[model samples]
Target: MAPQGVAIIGGGIFVKEEHLPAVLACPQLSLKAIWSRSIKSAQETAKLIPGDASTSVDLYSSDSGEGKSFDDVLKRPDITGLIMALPITEQPAYIEKALAAGKHVLAEKPIAKDVETAKQLIAKAQKIAAETKATLSIAENFRFVQGYSYGAEQVKQLGKVTGFVVRISWSMQTDNKYLNTAWRAKPEYQGGMLLDAGVHFTSALRKLLGPENAVDSVIAQTSLIQSYLPPVDSINAILKTKSNVVGSFIFSVGTTLSAFDFLIACENGSVQAEGSRVVTTRGAGQNATKEEKTFEKSNGVKEEVSAWAESMASGTPNPQQAPEMALADLELLEGMLTSGDKDGARQKLELQHHV
Candidate 1:
């Protein structure tokens, strides 16, 4: 089969570092063009596409002449797909336009700035997809991470889930590259850094718990400890998943403390995932058996893009990257913030995904 030509629609940090490498690594995809809001940024990204690819890849931007604008990229017949990583609030319109132009889209996560917008985009995309057969796949790298999948499978085999705990903390300092983005610095969106970063954890949590034990509700207390990260930067919540299983979720990106792990205890054993490692313990104290496994450290962008390309080729959407799945992750994070604002009033998730 011939490789599908695709364009990248964002020329930011992640587009240069993660998406570029991922696209280059996928043999099924041909790097065709690059687009950004500025010509300089688009040219900067084009420079990273190595040798032969560099010579063939076109650069487009908002400032471009008529034939080299973003709309031109969408009008391209050879470019049948797009890998977009734009700012959260600005992505939906671009996504809709691309799909309407009959191009499959592998869009960045936290589907939208909030749930209502996400739903609207999904509805519009579905209508466009039905007409053009173009697809929308949301990118959530945690779903493709090997450790989380292994941990999730381990949880399923360890019998009924009893309880779980997710504790993660990291400092997003003044000099942090990701935090330096103008949109991220003074996020105009809801939940600020918490919404931007928490969605990944929410996706991981859902993956580890499996569909049968999907999170159903959350009651959380949120606060802004960092003067820089506005609205809120921390969340302490209790999650209730299917089958009445309960868990505690604590996430803070504004603290000096550094830690990260997700542990699920079951009737027969417990599985924990930390970074690229998975550890499991089974049986009673003295007689217990324990094992640990490590996976190659990766951002999971390669596997995710590979999967997205495969889905495009097969004409079947990858369930993991479905807009519904991304919506679920955003819904969970938004639920936490909504609960936080109401002083820990329980927020029930209506769109929780199963598996």
Candidate 2:
């Protein structure tokens, strides 16, 4: 099959560092164009695409007088797909437009600012896709990470999962490039850094626990530890799964401490994951049998892009990071914040489906 021509819609740090490289690396995908708010930023991002200058990637912007506008790019018949890395609030409209143009879409996590908008966008996309036969996928890269995949497999060996715990923390200083973005610094989007970063962990948690266990309810406490980001910066939540499994999650983007840990306890054994290493233990303390495995480190961008391109070519949606799955991640994050605001009151997950 011919490589699917994909245009990237956002020219930010992640686009340059992750998406661009991933697009370049995916044999099924061809780097076609880049669009940003400004032509200069789009040009700068185009420089990062590896290729001869004679065959340079096209650049477009909302304000660019020389290049094609956003609508023009969407109208182009050659571009088969779009990879969006825009803000959470700005994604739904573009996604709708792209789907209407009959282009497959792979958007970044947190489908929309809220569940209602997400549902509307998804329904519209699905309608267009059914009529036009275009595909829609979310770029929840955590689901594609090799280490997380291995850890999830190990979790399955532990028999019926009883409970789990997830801890993710990192300090976002003023100098951080991601935080330096005006929208991220003073996010008009819901959940600020928490929602922006929280979706990844929520996606991971959902994948690790498997589809049988859905986060039925959540009780959470949130605090604004950092003055730079508004609303909330830290979250401590307890999740109850539909199958009666319990889980705890702690997410902080302002704390001085740095950690990433996920442990799953089951009737037969336990699986503990810290970064790329997953350790599985069974039996009592004295007779405990432990096995440790470390996977190659990856941000999973390449895998995700490749999968998206494959799906676009084959006319089958990648089941791993479906739109509804991403919506479930958003639901969990939103539920946590909602519960937190009510003094850790329990918020039920009202979504009808689970991935």
Candidate 3:
């Protein structure tokens, strides 16, 4: 099949750095257009596109006085899909518009600002998708990372899961590019940085635990350590999966501490992942054997984009990038923040979807 003609709909930091590179690198996709809220930003981002794509790609801006606009691009016959990474609160409307225009979409997560908004958007999008025969895939690139995928398979082979622990700590400095974004710095949304960054860890952990062992409940305590990070930036939670496997999740983006690890212990053995490396140990004591695998340059952004292009080409959505999965990730993060707000009151997850 000919490459699917698609457009990059946002001109923000992530769109310029990650999404643009990944979309340009995907052979199954053709860069037909680039749109930003401003024409100047759109043109600047287009410069990053090399060779033929730089000339072939059209530019549209929402603020333009001419006919060149996002809606105009959507009306074009050549563009059949959209890959977008907009501010969390500004995404749902764009998603609805794309689906209504009968274009497939690959949108960045946490799906929406919260579960209720996500549910409403998803329900409407699903109906439109069914009628238009188009697809909507929420991008949670952590689901495609090498270490997490390897660890997940190891979990299946390691027998009954006993428990797990996830530790993530890093300071989002004032100079941090992501933190510099206005939406992130002020964050009108709930859980602030906790909601924005927490979904990534949640997706990875859920990927390792698999569907049958999805997180069912959480009791957490959250706090804002740095004054600039807004509502909250740290969370410590105890989680229980549907299979009775218990685990602890601790994430803090406002601290000076810089450590990250996800460990799953099973009856026969255990799997541990730190960044791009995954280690598995089997057997006991002197007989215990350990093997470690390291992945380089495997952030999964390109892989996830390529998967979305393939799914769009084949007219089927990849379950790994399903909206429901994104919803589950958001639910877990929201549950943690909700429980934290209630002084560690337990919160149950009812909208979680498994794959």
Candidate 4:
């Protein structure tokens, strides 16, 4: 099959650093165009697409105030898919437009700013896909990351999971280019840095625990230690899954300490992951056996982009990071925030059934 022609919308730091490289690496996808709010940025991003004249990437912008608009890109017969990297608040409308135009869409994570909006967008997109036979997916790179994949497999080896704990902390200095983005600094979305990056950690936890167990309820506390990050930047939650398994998570972007740790304790054994290393222990104290595995660091952008392209070509949705799964991730985060607002009172998580 010929490579499916796709265009990337939103020319930001992530687009330049991750998506561009992934698009170029995926043999199943052909880059056709780049769009940004600014045409100059679009042109600059286009230069990163390593290809000959036959593969020349077109540039368009919403701020151009002149030439082809976003709708024009959607109307292109040659472009059958779109990869959206816009702000969380700006994504849903574009997703609707793209799917309505009968174009497959791979959007960035967290699905939407909140659950209600996510449900509405998902409902509308599903209806369009049913009618037009288009594919819609969320780009959750953590699911494809080498370390997380390894950790998940090790978790399964530990037998029936009883409980787990996740801790991720890091300082976001003012010098960070990505954090300095206008939308991020003064995000219209809830939870500020927590909502933006916390979804990935929640997705990772969900992957480790498996789909059979849904987050049932949560009790949490939130803090905004970072003056620059409005709303909140720190979150600590205690969660209970549908299967009765309990878990705790602590995520902070305001801390000076840097750490990443996830541990799952099961009936027969336990699995622990610290950074890129995963350690599995089986048996009791004296008989305990330990095995360690280390995975190469990868952002999984290429893997996700490849999966999207293959799905578009075969007319099947890649179930790994589907929109529904992303919505579930959002529910977990939103539930925590809501529970925190209620002074750590347990809040039940509401999920929408996806066909």
lDDT of 4 by residue, 51-170 (tens): 573258888898876556898898889998999999999899999989999999999987999999998998998899888887789999988887777877777776788899999999
Candidate 2 Cα misplacement greater than 4 A, ranges: 51-54
Ranking by TM-score: 1, 3, 2, 4
Off by over 4 Å in 1: none
C-alpha lDDT of residue 123 in model 2: 91
TM-score of 1: 0.98
Which tens-of-lDDT digit does each residue in 162-189 have in candidate 1?
9999999999998999889999998989
Whole-model alpha-carbon lDDT for candidate 1: 0.92
What lDDT would each prediction earn against the true structure? 0.92, 0.85, 0.90, 0.85
Output the worst ten-in-a-row residue range by lDDT, candidate 3. 346-355
User: How much is the lDDT of residue 52 in candidate 2?
Assistant: 90
Model 4 lDDT at residue 320: 86
Candidate No. with top TM-score: 1
Model 3 steric clash pairs: none
For all candidates, the clash counts are 1, 0, 0, 0
What TM-score should be assigned to candidate 3?
0.97
Q: Residue 246 of model 2: what lDDT?
A: 84
lDDT tens readout by residue for model 3, 1-355: 7888999999988888899999888889889999999899899999988786599899999888677998998998999899988899999999999999999999998899999999999899989977987788999999889899888998899898899999999989889888888888889899888888889999999888888788889999999999988798899999998889899999999999987999999989999987599999996688899999999857789999999988887777898998999998999999999998999999999966565
